[model samples]
Target: MKILRAEEEEALSEALRVLSEGGLVGFPTETFYGLGADPFNPAAIERLYEVKRRRRDKPVLLLLGDREEVGRLVEEIPPVAELLMEHFWPGPLTIVFRARTDIPPWLTAETGTVALRVSSHPLARDLPRLFRGPVTGTSANLSEEPPARTAEEVAHYFPEIDLILDGGPCPGEKPSTLVSVVSERVELLRPGAVPWEKIEKLLKSFS
Candidate 1:
């Protein structure tokens, strides 16, 4: 495992290289340090599950570079999801959508849905954009443990990580609010950085 400053000229390329080859990279997100794996690489995802001690039954969420990338994941964006993405994307909100049939079941834990977010963290957002694909956004820590707030914490948790882009300490706040727009009833899977009351108000605006 190696720690590289996030601003280092080679950090982005190195991360892309590791991810492309189905290796893991530890990077900072708006809320915490997360493990970056090629969302398209099932083998890498399996490794991620093992590294984090995360259960395979719980689907992993993905981080996107931007709002437009949603097309690559979902078949149709619900009207509510559209509005939420307009207001909350590139921030701390993860919206769940009915994934494209072609998306491997392993990625979604056979749930047939995928959770995605566009992070506001500069380095975090750039990683996926440069990778040209979604990156696993699961926090870098053993499952059921507090999420790691610093790159060092991530390294300590998993010493075998391929690369770690240290973006310094994260906000260390509540994680992104997770809501599902897969059906007419918008469901709140996790209440977090984006308040549910605020989102409920937005849902009311849906005409």
Candidate 2:
């Protein structure tokens, strides 16, 4: 794994090039570094699973730089999801929605729903927009291992990756809260940086 400081446009462009070529990249997100790959590239996604030793049954999430990218993946954005996106997107909330049938089959595994987030971290957020598509947002770590907060740590864990965009150290907070809106109701899958209480309160106001 090569560690390239993401201090210049040149580095980001090269990272994008790697992504375009279906190679893996480690990028800094608000909570931790996320491994990036073209969501449409099945071979790349399989390689990611092999590298992380992650089970194929556990689906990975997609990182978006723009909300418009959402239309390209999900079958529909339920009202609850739209409301949550309005309030918590570009932050730390990852909302899972029913995937469109045309979306890459490998992305949703057996869940048939795709987890999506509009990241606030500059690099993580910008990469998708630059590439004009979503990127896999799985934490850059081996399965069951703690997520990496620094580029060096990512390098330590993954030597099989194509590149690591070293955006210094991440904020290293709790990882993003994960929720699902695919069942016609909001369900909390993982409570994290975004407190469940706050999400409950907001939904309560409308209910």
Candidate 3:
């Protein structure tokens, strides 16, 4: 696997080039390193699952550019969820909402709910912007293996990836906080960078 320096302009250009070809790229995020692919490409998504040995039942999270994009993916956006997105997006919070028909069932696990995040990491932000649509942000390690925090760790874990963008060690090095907003009820699926107390407070704004 080829390793590119973090934030190196040439590396970014090359990474985009590989992604455009429907190949996989590994890069660092505010949390852990993630294996990314064109979310709209079913074949690419299949490769991702095969690489991680992940089950089809587990849906992948889409890293978005902004809140406006979120509206396009989900059929409805709750008011409280909006506040959370506004306050914590582009940081480390992941919000799950009812996805629209536009996204394929494989990406959303055939469930109406889809996880979306606006990453704060520069590489994470640029990677998605370079793609036709949002890219999958699942961890680079094989299923049940500890998530990779560095580019080398990712390369070691998934050697078959087409490209590796070594953007140094992941900062905060934790997974994005995950919350699901369904039927007006907000629930925390996994707490990572954003704590539960803060998320609960945001939910109260809706009440």
Candidate 4:
């Protein structure tokens, strides 16, 4: 597998090329190294699941360059979701929304909802912007293994992955907080980088 430094322009360009061609690229996020694949590509998504040995039932999370991209995947952006994104996005929070009809079943795992995060990490944010589409932001480790914090750790787990954007060790070393907003209320699915108290306070403010 080719290893590239995330800061280099040439590496970024190559990573985009790989994604456009339906290949996987391992890159660092605020929390951990994520295996990125074009979320719109069924072949790429399937390969990602196969490589990580991820269960098909568990849906993958998507990373976006900005909040606007959320509309492309979900049917509607609820008021509570908008409030949360306004406060905590471009950071470590994944919000689940009712997906648009066009989104693939593989992406939603037939749950009819998609989890998304507008990443603050430079590599994570720029990648989707450059690729001009969403990318899978799942941790680059075998299912149930500790998430990889460094590119080297990712290599040990997914040596055959197409490209590695080595941005050095991730600062957070934890997954994003996951919340489902299908109903009017916000349900905390998983808590990690963002504290639950913070989210609760934000929701209370909206009320």
Candidate 5:
């Protein structure tokens, strides 16, 4: 396992290289360190699941650099989703949307929806932009294990990963709030960093 300073140009370059070759790269998000892989590459996604012992039926979230990246993966961003993105994105809110028909089933767990977030962390945001594609944003730890908050923690949990981008400790220890907008209505799946009341308040304004 190679541990590199995430702030270094060399480390960023290596991360892009490893991800391009369908390898696992452990990097930090605002909430926790995550196992990053090319979401579009089936092999990479498979490797991610193997590394974390993640369940096959569970889908991984996609981390993006900007809202424009959503066009590549989703069919359309509902108005509610757009409002949420404008207010809560680049922070700790993950929105699930109907995916484009061509997206790999593995990404959606056959549910035909993709969870996406525009990460606020510099490393999380910059890496996807540098990769020119989305990357898996699942926590870097074995299934049922505590999420990694630092590079050292990531190494302790996943030493066999191709690279660890050490960006110091994650700002928040909790996961992002997950909301699904599948049936023209917003559904709260999991509430973590963002409060459900806040989301509801925002949505209520549209009513």
Candidate 6:
């Protein structure tokens, strides 16, 4: 087990290196520790599912640096979704969009929509940027296990992970709000760190 300083570029590089080589790396996010692997790599995604004992029907979130990166992964970025992105990105908000042809089934869980988030946590944001492509951003724990709040917790849950980037405890003991943006409006699927009232306000402002 190894703990990488979140701010250090070497740590990010090392994690990315392992991911590029199809290895799993557990890292911190604003919501919880996430087990990361190359989003485009089907084998790596499968390995991630194996590590977490994740359900094939449940989809994984794709973390990116900014809107442009998000745009690249999805089929279309609706105007309302853009407004939400402008306010809530680099934070705990996930917008689900239709997947592009390039997105893998492992990512969307055989669904046409892909879940995406631009995290606020520096290391969480940096890890995805380092990869320069999306990495699977599901919580680091076995299926039905509590989501890990610290890297040590992640290590305990996923002992076989190639590397564990311990970035201390997450900001809050909660997950990101998830919304589907494929229709004329944004629909909240899961209530999380970002409350439904706040999302509703954002939608009203955009409308």
TM-score of each: 0.97, 0.97, 0.94, 0.98, 0.97, 0.95
Global lDDT of each candidate: 0.90, 0.91, 0.84, 0.91, 0.90, 0.84
Clashing residue pairs in all predictions, respectively, total 0, 0, 0, 0, 0, 1
RMSD of each: 1.0, 0.9, 1.4, 0.9, 1.0, 1.4
Better structure of 1 and 3 per TM-score: 1
Cα-based lDDT at residue 187, candidate 5: 96
* Tens digits of per-residue lDDT for model 2, 1-207: 567889875888999999999899999999999999997888899999999999988889999988878888899988898889999989999999999988776889877889999999988988998898889999999999999999889999998899999999998879999999999799999988999999999999988
Residue 171 displacement (Å), model 1: 0.9
- Judged by whole-model lDDT over C-alpha atoms, candidate 1 comes out at 0.90
Q: Kindly provide the TM-score of model 5 when superposed on the true structure, using C-alpha atoms.
A: 0.97
Give every collision pair in model 1: none
Q: What does candidate 6's lDDT look like per residue over 51-121, in tens digits?
A: 87878898988888766887788898888888889899989998999999877777888888899998998
The digit string of per-residue lDDT tens for model 3 on 1-207 reads: 688887676898887787777789998889999888888888989999999999999999888766677877888998777788878988889888988988789988988779999899888887787664688888889999889988889988888989999878886456788888876677888979988898777667656
**Backbone clashes (count) for model 2:** 0
Task: Candidate 1: list runs displaced more than 4 Å.
Answer: none
Residue pairs of candidate 5 with colliding backbone atoms:
none
Give the C-alpha lDDT of model 4.
0.91
Residue runs of model 6 more than 4 Å from their true location after superposition: none
Name the better of 4 and 5 by TM-score: 4
lDDT of 6 at 82: 84
lDDT comparison, 3 vs 5, better candidate: 5
